[model samples]
Target: MPLRGILDRWNNQSLARQFLIAGGLVSLAAMMLVGAYVTTLIEAAVTRNSAASTALYVDSIIAPLLPDMKTSQRLDDVTTRALDETFGQGALGGKVVSFRLWRKDGTVLYATPDKSMVGKRLDPGEDLLTAFSGQMVAQFGSAEPRDASERSRDDPLLEIYNPILQPWSGEVVAVSEFYEVADEFQQSLHQAQLRSWLAVFGVTLAFFLLLSAIVFRGSRIIDHQQQALTQRVTELSELLSQNKALHARAQRASLRATALNESYLRRLGADLHDGPAQLVAYAALRVDSQLLTDPRTPHQAREKEVSTIKARLDEAMDEIRSICSGLVLPQIETAELPDVLKRAVDAHRQRTGLKVALSMTNGSKSLPPSAKICIYRFVQEALNNGFRHGGGVDQSVRQTFDNGNVVIEVADRGPGFDPASVGPDGLGLAGLRERIESLGGTFNIFTSKSGTTVRMSLNVQEMEQA
Candidate 1:
């Protein structure tokens, strides 16, 4: 039952409660076991000493006097005297002796402090039966019932019992007992148990307090790290939002540039078709008519003049054709940049009678009409420059598409010119560069001892949807 209760308490308690309860229980059990062991040891030691002292008193005085005695009463008197001398006065509650004399037939012959117990039949079931059998008995403290007078007192009594022997025959004759109280010892043990319980409780509380402090510190560090992580996430979110806005703005700018280029090319095509082409046609007609009918005295000078006029007219036709070709713009959503580049190369070749090679890498994909027209004009300008200033008449123009970019390059095996010497005002290459860059594209020119190459990259996807 006690074990079951301890198990229940252990299971029901919280961690701290369990610790405290277990500590207290262990301290209590250990103290109680120690106290019980100490009491038993003291009792054993006291019993052994008392038995030895009683035997010595009996052997030296009572046992020697029994040889001279003639009757049981006389032997009783000698045993009483011996007990009084050994235990001293008032030691056995003013009795001076404590002894019970019995015969071999289990009859009581004498008892100290009273004569009424003499000649009494000894009931083996009554007090001192084991003593009559010649065995020693020992007890500590008093067991008497207290009356009102004795109940108010603080002191208690102690007791001891031993068997007496006969002289010469060495037979047991009577029993003897003594007692003394020990109230102070019980009080001291109770105080020590209380002190032990208090020390256990104090130590348990201190240990719990230390553990709580450590847990609090660790929790604080975790909270700080979580807070820092949250702040960093907030900062990154804001940065991403700003970056998206910048990208949107850049896309809008590219669309605007594309629109402007397309409009410019459309207007340029209109001007050339309506004005320069008509004028060039009229001049050709006049030259043909004059060559057929007009006659002069030399005819040689007239023929030369007519020939010069015809040549000028043809040059004007070529210029107007070149201008119109440069103005060729396709639909932004439908035209492929490579196809547009091919058309521009063909137009320039037809107009100038110059051998031009076109090569396309990757596949053709649609781009904004403005982007196509810009590339067309750039090629026109490059071809024109090569025709007028480049030493080589034949040139290779290569176009490449990769990922989402379209690269258009025009190179000639010409006497390469120094880009630094040709300032912005000297060659229209600077204007071409400006036009390409305005559309969110790049323009680059490389001139070496062998040749000159102009390259530009247009974002095909951006241009097609602009």
Candidate 2:
């Protein structure tokens, strides 16, 4: 298949499976490249540094021996002693040296690994006789010997050959040799490669783990959203079914109920304005007249009566207002849901002297009166629940709007109750849920150790019909 087709197929798979495959491939490739690069660079640097350091060490050893060799007439003993001292058993403990001293006649005077090689004609290939003509030669490779059996079993070697120059004329006198075991340098390079692999392995493991976690979390969120959408669709289907059955009954009952509700609200409003308010005004006049005329009645008692009358009047006014608001509207109209929510929150805060925060986003637009009413009632019920159960008096309420949905969340630092433990008898939230779902919306109530949150989303199109 083409790469694009393969990717499309992979994309259709579960997020976790796709992530594991893609992450493993990418991580493995990157690790391999990094490992190769790091191992090569480190090995090269180590080889170069080791070679330079060894060369310097050899020069230091050979430099001091040059003067001693030029001054001595008895070259054999002087050369032997100098060789023994320079390549002392301890000095060549971790190194290999094959030194051969020669006279101007191209004959060997001393060769280490054996005293027998002395007095032998220098083999041009096996012995570096060209260095005797006042030249320094250094090569990193295996050594050759005249006797095959005397050759090194270890493969590669780093050898440095320097000529012994006469101080006066700078003429070549004798030669010095130094060779290093390559196994140590090779082992260092192998260790560097191992470290590179280990580092790459560690980073790859962490990368795969992080990728897996992201995939798992994203998959779970997708599943949750899908489930929520499915539930919402199911609810809407059921609501439509119920609406079909109730349409005839609603036509018969809704008009009468709405008329009666409006009439009751207007009567209640008039009763409050005409009854308790007027009664309170008359009682205040009585108290004022008593305070001015009656010296028999104590001032404190008169003042107590006046305060009691005022408290009763306030309670009566509140009762009347509550009764009137509980009545449903007679006619519906398109209203912006956020504006209704803001008014509800504002009214609650004003009555309780609590702080409220309202945030609206997107362009303010109109919604169906039913959705506005449902959302307004949801906020009202939530605030009531907060006051009754959440100890939300003098607390803060926050409402947020996004897209075409409004989220009214009232939180209090007061003692919270577990939503899971709420019984069937708790009709407040049940009724709120019914109202919200009646308009093809979703309702979610979340309560935790910190506080409680009630979230509901209304479909903008459906809400416009309401």
Candidate 3:
């Protein structure tokens, strides 16, 4: 119906059908060409070899009758009788039906049973000219219509014109024309031509079959290899997609890590400026004023001023130590998960002097060192936030292991502020969220007028093994 439809149908065809159609068309075209060429060659070969044999037979029997015709330019009485005896009334083995002796100028010297044609000059055609040139020429055709007598005896004839050579000189003197019945010989030639054609066709068919078989096997192998290549390409595409997703995740983690480092630096700067830096600056100012106002006013007063300065210096040192303690963590490489959480809670209690109710459930005790640090920091920050912002009432910390996950919750029964109204730099919630997510954990908060609860869950086995 359409070009596209034809293509679709051909594509849907089976491989065997497609190959067979193509091979058949190719074989037919090749055989047709070969058959035509072979037939032409065989015909030429058969004609050349058959003509040579027939001409040789005619020469041996007929050449003796015309030996002296060069000088006579005509056949004698004896030669004329001999010709009649050879060809008349089914004579000479019934092969020779008729005969003529011609001079070189196409003058008929003798004609058997047709004496009226004798001594008549006619045009010597191409076949007679070839014979007079010392070669025998033969063909199958009717006699020429130029002569009335020849036209009267018309039949399908095997005509031969042979040169009658002089015995001593080996020169052509006269030409002998003969017409023979060739029914049996024609049948044999036909049979040979038929056999040659069949043989050529058989060879062509066999060669085509062999070539088609080779093509079919190779096509099957190519199809299999193509299928394998397609499957391999699909698998590679899937792997590439997975690799791109992993790369994107790594980039996001890198950005979050940078943000966490910046937040940490900002917090450290603020702690130093508010605590140790302010105290140290004030002590320096007071020392400068005393030196300028009363360098030697009273020894006892200067001693008292030295005591106050010493107390202020001692307070500044304590504040610096407190900030340092917050920054530096205890060595807990060899500690258990429960022991690590207990240290954070004990430190909070020592610093704030506020009691926190703590509960724990049996869970995976072993953890990677990074995971231990995350847990301790999370508990520490949540407890500190509760005392500072939640009035430290009904504070509780709970730890449980559920379905291969470590779950932790910190809650307080105090008035909670709205998370939506929180300032950008308050309470380090964003840093806490990033910290938990970086470890492939989750952080969440539930706050209301009753209180606030901070919850975190981590894949214990995965985080520890990683």
- Provide TM-scores for the models: 0.39, 0.37, 0.54
Candidate 1 lDDT, 107-199, residue by residue in tens:
655454445566677555333667667766555454331133334444654334456665667676655443334455445545655555555
Q: How displaced is residue 259 in candidate 2, in Å? A: 25
Winner by TM-score: 3
lDDT of each: 0.63, 0.67, 0.79
> Could you tell which candidate, 2 or 3, scores higher by TM-score?
3
Cα lDDT for residue 316, candidate 1: 70
The lDDT of model 3 is 0.79
Angstrom error at residue 128, model 3: 1.8
Q: What is candidate 2's CA lDDT for residue 385?
A: 82
Which consecutive 10 residues in model 3 have the weakest lDDT in total? 141-150
The lDDT leader among the candidates is: 3
